[model samples]
Target: MSLMEISCIFPVTDIKKTACFYVSKLGYKAVEYLECKEAHICLYRDKTEIILLQAQTKNIFPNRELYGYGYDAYLYTDDQEKLEKEFLEKGVKIVKPLNVTDYKNKEFVIEDIDGRWIAFGLKIKD
Candidate 1:
């Protein structure tokens, strides 16, 4: 079996803020907003898609724990320089700055408002 697309679901504390961040800061477009009491914002960039689900449950877990014990998502891009510049200019928190690695690519890491890790990279051409 072959995979068609991958969608990461992130539990957000504030739906509106998270939605805005994805749209304005990350440059992702909202494909559809599910009509439900609990807000579900569906966003996509090219083929990659993500769903931001506002947690209706009254669990008092920390933001990191609520989203998942570890990283809830990662976004890979071919335009590393442009992506990095845009994110930095927008004042998005950069967990790791852009750097070229021996592994054969230039990459950087940034965290969304909700603390989700987004790694942008460009493959090195020989």
Candidate 2:
């Protein structure tokens, strides 16, 4: 057997709003959009795929902070610096600025409208 692709699904308060953000702010394409009792949106960027689902029931906890966790997603990008600058210009909610971690990755964190923490980064090679 062979493993295929994977898509991360997030429970957002509003699918349309989140999709717009992903499309405009994060540079993703709306592959599918659906609204009903439960809203669902599928976004694609290059080979990456992200899905946003309108949360009906209450979540176990609020954002990652209140949940005592962090980093809902780690988005790997080759052009980290340029993308970070673009996000800043777009006034994206940055949880943290770009910095080299001990693990040696140049990375920054972005907070979505729903408070999901997404870390975007690239490897720092010596």
Candidate 3:
């Protein structure tokens, strides 16, 4: 068996607010399932999907906060420049601009409403 797709799950203090950020800033469609046993919001954009779960605590601890250096999520994309430009035009906070990493990945990072750093890039093949 082979894996088909993967979705990022984030625990957010306010599901509606977090979902709004993704929907407005990131241009993702949000579907609320607050009536479900596990209340959550599903964000969709292209082939990407992020599930926002209602957090028990008000504060969110992103990976970089606990690990010192790490991204909450790394999404692979074909057109880095275009995506970066689109995000910038949308008023999204780009914590890191488009740049080639030491590992040879053309990537850029954005700071989400929950302070999560998400990197979007594609590996460069020489």
Candidate 4:
């Protein structure tokens, strides 16, 4: 079966606050923000779209817990350095510094406003 586009839906405490972070810090635009009973917002950046849904509780995993409680998001991009620089300048908490993994992947990880682990990586060249 052929698959189309796949986007993420993250549960957050507040949609406006979370949406603002993506817009101001991560360079995402708020495509849709519904402030009804179920607060929700949709952010768009380049060809990617992320949906933030207001939830009652949070399920953020600790940095050390990399096993069962997995990362909330894992993303790949070509502009790794540019994104790292931008995130650093914005005072974003880069949990892990950019480095080459033993698996030969050059990547870094960052935590979002909702405490979700978002990892970005790029393939390393020989």
Estimate candidate 1's alpha-carbon lDDT, on a 0 to 1 scale.
Answer: 0.76
lDDT of 4 by residue, 82-124 (tens): 8899999998889888988888888899988878778888788
lDDT of 3 by residue, 11-125 (tens): 9999999999999898899998999999999999999999999999979999988989899999999999999999999999999999999999999999999999999999999
Q: Which ten residues in a row have the lowest lDDT in candidate 3?
A: 58-67
lDDT of each: 0.76, 0.82, 0.95, 0.82
lDDT of 4 at 31: 69
Task: Please write out the lDDT profile of model 1 over residues 6-109, one tens digit for every residue.
Answer: 88887777877888898998889985465777558898878788898877764425435665544445566788888889888988899879998778868888
Q: Provide the clashing-pair count of each candidate structure.
A: 0, 0, 0, 0
Least accurate 10 contiguous residues by lDDT in model 2: 57-66
Cα lDDT tens digits, model 2, 19-87, are 899988888998655745555788998878998887776552435667677688888888878988999
**Candidate 1's error at 73, in angstroms?**
2.2
Candidate 1 regions exceeding 4 Å error are: 37-39, 57-70, 101-105, 122-126
TM-score of each: 0.76, 0.83, 0.98, 0.83
Top candidate on lDDT is 3
lDDT of 2 at 10: 85
Candidate 4 lDDT score at position 110:
91
TM-score of 2: 0.83
